[model samples]
Target: MKTDVLIAGAGPVGLTMASELSRYGLSVRLVDKNTQRTDKSKAIVLWARTLELINRMSPNCADRFIETGLKTESVNILSGSEHIGHADMKEVDSKYKFVVMIPQSDTERLLEEHLATFNIKAERQTELTDFKETSDGVTYVLKHADGSEETAEASWLIGADGAHSIVRHKLNKEFHGSTLLSDWMLADIYLTGVQGTPAINIYWHADGILALFPLQGTRHRIIANVGESSGPIGEGNRPAPTVEDIQRVLDTRGPGGIKAEDSVWRSNFSINERKVDDYRSGRVFVAGDAAHVHSPAGGQGMNTGMQDAFNLTWKLALVSRGICQPEPLLSSYSAERSPVAKVLLEFTGRATEAALLRGGVKQSIRNHVASLVLGFAPVTHTMANLLSEISIGYSDSPLNAHTQHPRHGVKPGKRALIRENEPPVGFGDAPRFALFAESNNLPSALLLKYSALLEATPRAPLSPDSLSLVRPDGYVALATKSGDWNAVDAYLNQFLPKAS
Candidate 1:
C-alpha cells in the first residue's frame, strides 16, 4: 500500500482521522474536491469532552485552536414567557465549558495547521473517481482538477464526506431514517451580547426551534426550523435570509432582550435525522456525516465525527504495527461509537421536536411544566454536559471483562496517569495494546505468557499494577489489575499470537 490510510474529504472529521493516524507513524493521504476551506463557519462549537479527547490525542491541541475568540460560558433555554432552564458548562469543571463557538472554517484551518506539522496536506480539487476494494485494502483513482488521474492504494479508506457521500453509496450502507419535510433557516451574524453572558437557545414551541450559538466574542449563529405552514424556501440552501428574518425572530422574543445585529453570512437548511446501517465496510469505513447525519440541535455533528476519528485512529495504528489482531481492535470502533451516536440522535431529535412546536394550550402546558420541573431538578444541571459531549468508558466493554486487584493509589477502569502523582480523571490513549503486569515486576510475566500481547504491546505508560491494553485505534482495549498468568494468558491468546 502506498499509503496506510486514504481519507476522502478534508472536512473536520476526515482531517482529524488523518492527523490521528499520522500520529501512529502511518502514512496518511487526504483528498478533497473543495478547492479551499471557506472563511464562513458552519458548525460553530466544540464541546468540552471532545476538546479533552483531542488534547489527549495531541497534547498541544487545545492551546492551538482554543482562542478567546472561541468560548461560550453557558446555555439558556427560554420556554414561552418564562426562563425554563440553563446548562452551566462551567459546572463540568472543564477549562472550556458548554461548547467553544468557532466557525467551521476556522476549525478546519486549525486542524490543517496541525496536520502541516506532521507533513501532511489535503490533496485539494482531487476527487475519487474510481475505487476498488479487495480483501486486503482499497485502491482509488484520484482525478486531479487538471484532468490527470493517478491511482493510490491504502490499507484502509475512510469516508468523511458529507451527506451526499459517494463512498457510502458505493458501500450500500442503508441510511434508514426520516428527513424533516419542513424547511429551516440558518444564519451567522454579530450579536450585541457581551463576551461572557450565557448564550440562549430558546424553544418557544409555536415559533419553531430557534437556537443562538455564541462565536468568538460578539458574533453569533441562529438556526430556526420553519413551520410547515410557513412554506419552504423555493431554492432550499439558498434562502437569501435578510435582516427581516432576524428582526422578526427577535421581535417575537418577548422583552428584556439582547439584540443581534450586522448579519455576516446567511443560508437556509432542512433538518434531518439519520444513521447508517453500519459504519464499517471491509477496508472502507465511514465517519462523520458520512456514517451518521442527524439534526444539529445538540451541536453534536462535528463533535461526534471527531470522536469517531479518536476511536478509530489508535486501533488502525496498532493493527498496522502488529500489536494485536486487526479484527478485535477494529470491531470495537463501531461498537463504541454507534451507541454514542444513537443517544445523540435521540437527544437532538427530541430537543428539535420540543423547539418546533405549533401554537396550542397543550404546548404551553408541556413547555411550562418542563421548564418548572427542570429548573429545580439537579439532573437538569447536567443537561449541558450531556449535550456537550460524553466521556466514553470501556468498563462496560465485553472485551474488557476482568476482575480488579486493588492498588493503594491505583484504581481499576480509570485511565491511570503514567508518571503524575495526582489522581487522574482519565488518561492513556496510546496506539498499542498495553498490559500492566505489576506482578513481581519480572520480565518473565511480561515476556512469557503475555509475550504476543506484550512483545509489541508496551507496558502501561501509567503504572505497574495496571494492565492497560490498547486497541489498534488507540482506545483502551482492556485495563485490568495485574495478576496471575493463567487468566491473563488465556485472555490475550484469544486475540494475539502465542510466544515463540
Candidate 2:
C-alpha cells in the first residue's frame, strides 16, 4: 500500500492532520493500532482560537463538536465542601469558558466523520513495524492483524502516535523530560438518584484534589489527584479501582452522601512532561504527542497536539507541491512548537502543584492565594483561555515572517493576538495569507504576480488587511495593512510560486 502521506495514530491530532491534508487535495491515509474508538472523554475543551480555526476549515464542524459535547460555564474551586471561588469563562472572548465535557472516544468518532467527508478514514488494526526515512521520503513494513506483511511508501509520514511513539523511536529521537512522581484516575459516571449536580466542581481536600466535570448530557466525569491518582487501592488508597474499588469513590464522593450509579468508563494515567528533540527526520515528522507530552491538568495536552498537526500539514503541502524549500520550512516546525510545549508544560505543572498540596500553614496560605487569584476576573479568564488552547501564535515561518515590503505584513510574533471575525472562511487551501481590503479583493498590483499561490478575501474587515492568512493547519500565516504589497512577492516566494 502507498500514499502521498500516511499518518500513524489517528488520535484527534492525527485525524485532524489527515483531514487537513485532504482539504488541500492531497492523498492521505490515516492509520491506528486501536481496533476502534475508546469510550473515554479525556480532553474536553476547545479554546476560542481553535474554534475560530475550525470555523475557517468547516464552520459547522466546531459548532457540531460543541453541540455533541456537554458545555459548562463556571470553574468552581472548593476546599473540602467549602466554596473557595468560582471562575466563569463566559467572560473570555470565546463563547465557551468551562471545559466541554466530551469523551475522547466521541472526539475521535466525530473527527472521523469529518474526515470521511474528505474520503479519508483511519485504517484500523494495522501496525508499522519496520519504518525508515530518507531525504526523499519514507518506507514502512506494516503488519496486518491477519498475519500478513506489506510494504508501504509515502512522500511523507506523520507520527501522531502518542507518547511511546514508534515513529519517534524509529527516528532515534530522544524524549527529554521526567515522569511525574504521582499518578491519577479519571472516570465518567451517570447520576441515578442524585439531583442537580453542579456544572463543574473542584474539591481541595486534605487527602488530595478531586475535580468533577459535568459532561454535556451525562452527569459527571470525576478527575482525582489521589496521590498519584492510581495504584493499589487499600490503606485508604481507594483500593486500586476494581468495580468495587471504583464504586467506593463514587459512593463516598456522592453529593449529600448520595450514592450514584457505577462509572460507565474508567482510566488510570500518570503525569509527565517531555518533548522530542526533533520534530522532522527527513520525510517523516512527528506531531501532537509524538512531539510533546505533558500532564493533563491544564487540558492543554490535546490542544497542543492538534496545533502541531495544524502547523505541520500546510508546510508539507507547500513543499511537496514545489512551493517552497522543504528544509527551512521543515526546520521551522521544531522552532515554532518547542517554545509552546515549554510554556504549556510549565503552566500545567504549576496548576497541578497548586491543586495537590500537603496540609500545613504554608499549604493553606498557598490555597488561599490560589483561591483569591482565581476569584479575580483576569486570573480565571487567563487560565480559561489557555485551556481552550487558542492563545498561542507561531514565530517566523516563510508564510508568517515579517517582510520588508510594508504595513503590518508581519504580525506580533508568536504572541500576536487578533480579534476573531464573525463569518470566517479560508481562501481555498490557504492557511497562511488572508487578504482584507475595503474593496474585498486582492491588491490589484500584486494579484497577477502572486495570484497562483495567494487568495485575497474581503470578508467583513479584519483591520487594514482586515483579512488574515491562515497556514494550511490554521494559524495566521501573515497579516498586512490594507493594500500593502511591497514584500508580497518576497513573502510568497518563501512558500509558493512567484513571477519568473
Q: Which model scores highest in TM-score?
A: 2
Task: Enumerate clash totals for all models, in the order shown.
Answer: 15, 22
| lDDT tens digits by residue: candidate 1, 1-500 | 47889999999999889888887678889999989976788777788767776665565467666773466666777755567777777676454555677788988998898789789999899998668897778989888999999987888899988787889888888876777766777778787743346465665646666677767666778777655624543337446678777767755652335576888887877776888867887788899999887887778898899988887887687677676677676786787777778878888888777766676886787777777776874666567558666434554444563645434223333333333332122233345344545545445654665543453434534454565554433344444555544545555666663466
C-alpha positional error of residue 239 in candidate 1 after TM-score superposition, expressed in Å: 2.0
Model 2 lDDT per residue over 1-500, tens place? 55789888889998888987887768987888888866667776665666555555665567777787766676777775566777666766554444566677787888889889887788888887778876667888777889799887988888888888999998889898877667676676665543453456666766667777777554577777556534443223343355555455545543455444666776666777888777887788888888888877766788778778767777777777676667567888878888889888888888788877777776689778877777787777776666666467665443464644335533534333343544443425544444444554445767665554555443444454443444444455556665445544555666554467
What is residue 181's positional error in candidate 1, in angstroms?
Answer: 2.2
Q: Which stretches in model 1 have alpha-carbon errors above 4 Å? A: 93-98, 193-200, 229-238, 254-257, 394-398, 402-430, 433-444, 447-490, 497-500
lDDT of 2 at 122: 82
List where candidate 2 sits over 4 angstroms from the true fold: 95-98, 192-198, 216-218, 228-258, 395-400, 403-410, 414-432, 438-445, 456-461, 464-474, 477-481, 497-500
The top-ranked prediction according to lDDT is 1
**lDDT per prediction?**
0.70, 0.68
Give the true-structure RMSD of model 1. 4.1
Question: Candidate 2: lDDT over CA atoms?
Answer: 0.68
